[model samples]
Target: MEARMPDPVAGPITEKSDHPRTEGDPQEDGDTPRRVVLADPRSYCAGVERAIEIVERLLRDRPGPIYVRKQIVHNSHVVADLESRGAEFVDELDEVPTGSTVVFSAHGVSPAVRAAAEQRRLEVVDATCPLVTKVHAEARRFTARGDTVVLIGHADHEEVEGTLGEAPETTVLVETPQDVARLEVADPEKVSYLTQTTLAVDETREVIEALRARFPALRGPGSEDICYATTNRQDAVAAVAQEADVVLVVGSANSSNSVRLTELAQRLGTPAHLVDSARDIDPDWVVGARTVAVTAGASAPPWLVEEVIDALADLGPAIVSEHSVATEDVLFALPREVREV
Candidate 1:
């Protein structure tokens, strides 16, 4: 069945009682069923797909030990898969044998890293998500205008790090509303803000509000920098969280967007767990949950999400359905280097 369009103005996100009777479901309870509701637009955003494809194509076309600077998008499964294909994951460009081909992760990289790769004369294939690159562009433009850029994102996040490196001397990082309060900018009147593309939308909004309150003249991106995938998945969770007794998010602990989905569900008063795969789904967590909401991080592969659904099935028979908040049609073109490949 087609999903109903999400109406944000709709009342509290509520769980429905239309559960299917699972095999092991103690017949003691009434006809309430045990089921899993899958969130649409859940995994492998355009950027992640492009990043992974870049490596796959590179592997097919090049004779390499193709080196990737980061996890290539933060999913353990993805990195492992690429590793099995002869892609070397490294923390630094120095690890690449000077002349070997190298790829930057989808998370983007600092200018210094790019310079390092160039200095080593390494053949580079950049797989930075176009949306993240947009944030970096904002940072450069704001700093060039003499505005002190206040980047609202986790301090250590790769996306944030790359954006900060755009104009480090002119950019400052703030993670929360409180950070805005304690921030001491050189000129409040000339301040601007940008954000990590995958941050939790609601939390980032609060931080933005805090920044504006402190500096009424604060500037921000002409259009918000949080990517469509992040907003869509977060909104998708909001639509189903109210109806789910419990929510299970599939992705690595370090996946910011995946973690935010868990946080979003929790904020709605539902118990949520962040799992790397089906292996982490604790049978104990779903003890009393009649309906479970399943979603995957933007960087996560669909296979992991499927594995989770299978794991949930072992708990009992489940009516798995897709709860789509919105349809996503965004696509980014491959980098020029591999466009022909």
Candidate 2:
């Protein structure tokens, strides 16, 4: 199902003023609030919240060690926090004991992984994002129609891997438009395309355009595969990046959407960095920057954003305002496995 979020142009909470502190002046001595623009619709999409809650409920209700396959979400801090509370994250199903409860990650899994879990008799609680599940369903549908499916995303990403597994024999992964030229389909006229939910919108559009050029009869999902959260965050970043000197995206290194935010800001001619936390922020990056824009990925926790602002405040008195692009009120129901508990 699609996220129930409104798509709108970003509106600034307050009018930004010129830098009160000059380059030659000391940042610490500034009397004005240091400009910090926080992007609205940042952090913890509904799918991520659902996944984390499923694990938390299982940990609280069940006494046994709760096993999770891969990260419940992409954030390292989230994984570490859960690990401290007795959630065991594993690389493979073999690491989990037979007949024990195991939660699949939010990225979803291939049919092979599900079959492997079945063989081991692991009690499974799927935490796959509904959006990702939608992509998988599309893959299966296209493949069943005897169409060669072209998946757009990084080959190594967990989300892409799971989606690729949906129709391995019929599916091909393409990261860039250049890969489209080398693609070979059994029936050129009967090809369809799908994208990872977390890819950059502009880049994915380019790739889709290339695919259409190569195969004019290309089929696709009824709606774009990029989730609403990803699109909104990118739009927010683009808005702040234009007015900010430097942009800092709060999320782990492996988070695809977080990295996309940094890249988007850089593409807009603003210096940007992907920081896991405030400590990762290079002091130099913000020393001369008057307006520092901050945003978090879907997997990132909201508290982390506050911490970054606190860290920035340490440098000087900061004026923090949110530039909201959209309001997100979407909520996904807890999986049946953990719903009652």
lDDT of 2 by residue, 26-73 (tens): 475456556888887799999999999999999999987999999999
Residue 244 in candidate 1 has what lDDT?
A: 89
Q: After superposition, how far is residue 175 of candidate 1 from its true place, in Å?
A: 0.6
RMSD of each: 3.9, 3.1
Query: Where does model 2 exceed 4 Å of error?
Result: 1-3, 15-30
lDDT of 1 by residue, 93-174 (tens): 7778989999999999989988888899998999999878888888889999999999989978888889889999989999
Which pairs, if any, clash in model 1?
13-242, 14-243, 15-243, 19-33, 20-33, 22-317
What local lDDT does model 1 show for residue 210? 97
Off-target runs (Cα >4 Å) in candidate 1 are 1-32
- Candidate 2's clash total is 1
Clashes of each: 6, 1
Worst 10 residues of 1 by lDDT: 1-10
lDDT of 1 at 265: 97
